[model samples]
Target: MKRFIGFIKKEFYHIFRDKRSLFILFGMPIVQVMLFGFAITNEINNVDIAILDHSKDANTKQIIDKISASKYFSIKDFLDNERDIETAFKKGEIKAVLNFEKDFSKKLMTENQATVQILTDATDPNTANTISNYTSSILSSYQELLNKDISIPYQIGVQTRMFYNPELKSVFMFVPGVMTIILMLVSAMMTSISITREKELGTMEILLVSPLKPFQVIVGKVVPYILLSVINAIVIILLSIFVFSMPVEGNLFLLGAETILFIMNALSLGILISTVSASQQTAMMVSLMGLMLPVILLSGFIFPISSMPFPLQVISNIIPARWFIIILKGIMLKGVGLVYLWKETLILVGMTLFFIALSVKKYKIRLE
Candidate 1:
């Protein structure tokens, strides 16, 4: 009984002495819950939009006001010509554009019909589609108001054109998400476990004392995983294309490049995790519990971020997988190049750099 008690005490001391293990045991849950509970959302709000009102009459003004006043849209600018719509979308100033045909009131009253065009940047097909639906609902309400007092029937024809994804395939949405999960699991989880296994076997110290620099050692450990992740990404993409008939509308080279960036980001994250986990078991646990759940729930893979509570929406912005998925959907469905997805690309790049820097700093601290 005395020996068993002493053994338990020694184990507790060892766990407390290892800062990384203690953090994994205690700190990881707090971070995971905050990320999961706060970052997973499915609501959209304050979507930026541009309006082209050829009929600058009272009725047109009323409809525009309704759209602007709604929580779903913020009118950024009123354009003069149709040529500017593409420019605004490319500039990332607006997600949608409203085009009211000329003499809208005249057509509504005399001809008993009016036309309005809703053009959305379909790079993010789901968001673009949602914005269009909101806009249509607003216009429908206005139409009802205009006909409320009259026996004569009138209709507002909303011509909605979803650019990039005309059909809005559900497969278009999931391919990117699947790619993100696969890469995250393959790169981060695998690399962390591989590196930590060496520590568990007491081989890490021998490698640390060898001729290889810390960065070199980390790179060597991650490179094979990176290659495997790339292969996995390719396989997923091929399946999406051939089996699901998903379109690779954007530049294939760009898609490949972005996949590589995402894999690298995952690898850096794995290295950071490995630095904090002392054993293979700890690494696997952290990778699965601490990393996987957040990646799955917070990355906008299974749930729409806008639909979540506001706090969760804000937190979802920090997940690397969320940005990578956006980039993938843009390239795959919308055929958007770097011009459209540069922001997401830069975000992934920044996350990769941040993780690598953190891992380097933590490695230095441990060596000291």
Candidate 2:
């Protein structure tokens, strides 16, 4: 019984000494809880919306002031004409637009009715619908206020126009997000163990003794994953198209190119993780803990980035899945071409090169 107690004490000592174990036990849970708490919110804050006021009257100004005063939306643009609305949406910063019809005050005062169109970018249908509902609620409250003691009820008609996804189908958003997650899984999680597996099996030393260059070694290790990832990407796209009835409106070649770029970026990151990790389990833990959460939470997969806190929004720029999701959505839903997507494409390319260079540098150090 004494020896068993000693053994138990020894186990505790070992666990306490191992920082990684301690982190896994305590740190990870706290971090995950905090991340989920902050990032999983459905309520939007400081969402950028545009205003197109044709009347510019007292009622229009009051309604605009009420909307702008709210915490949910920030007025990003004051449009001159309807043509600029499409241009604003294409720029991607403007998520919603409030277009007040002509003679808003006149109509509301004389006819007891007025119309305001709520145009929303519905790439993520949930957000668009939520924005429309919130705006309508605000208008409804205003109508009630106007008719509080009056004999005739003042009516505010809200017309919602959902751009990119008129039907507000949930699948339209999920397909691109699922595609990003799957590709990241296939490319990063699998290859993250490649070098660690070699190190575990005692073949890493043999590879060091071999004449093959680090670049060749890394490339050789990741080639199969790259191919498999490409295949996986194609399958997801096909499934999205045939099964989910998702549209691929942009150039097929451009989409394929972007997909390949993202795959390479993920694979390179895996190689980097494998290079840094001492064991396959460590590699996987790092991959899962480090990559998965950021991909799911920070990448705008389920939540709108515009709604997240400023710091999380800034941090999300480093998440590869975010850019890839944007590219996929642009190509599939918006039918945008490289002209509009050049920035995201360049970012992925830069990330791929950065990871590969870092992994290669680490891999070369193994020889010395």
Best candidate (score: lDDT) = 2
- Backbone clashes per model, in order? 10, 0
Global fold similarity of model 1 (TM-score)? 0.58
How high is each candidate's TM-score?
0.58, 0.60
lDDT of each: 0.78, 0.82
Question: In candidate 1, which residue ranges exceed 4 Å CA deviation?
Answer: 1-152, 160-163, 364-368
Q: What tens digits encode model 1's per-residue C-alpha lDDT throughout 279-324?
A: 8788888878877787789888888887988988898898899999
Off by over 4 Å in 2: 1-156, 364-368
- List, residue by residue over 1-368, the lDDT tens digit for candidate 2: 45344434544454457576445434443343334334544557789999999999999999999999988899998999999999999999989999999999999889978999999999989789999988998998887788779775576656879989886666677778777876786578777775687788887788677765677667776766676677677767776688667899999999999999999999999999988888989999999899988998999989899999999999999999999999999999999999999999999999999999899888744633
**C-alpha lDDT of residue 299 in model 1:** 86
* Candidate 1 minimal-lDDT segment of 10 residues: 29-38
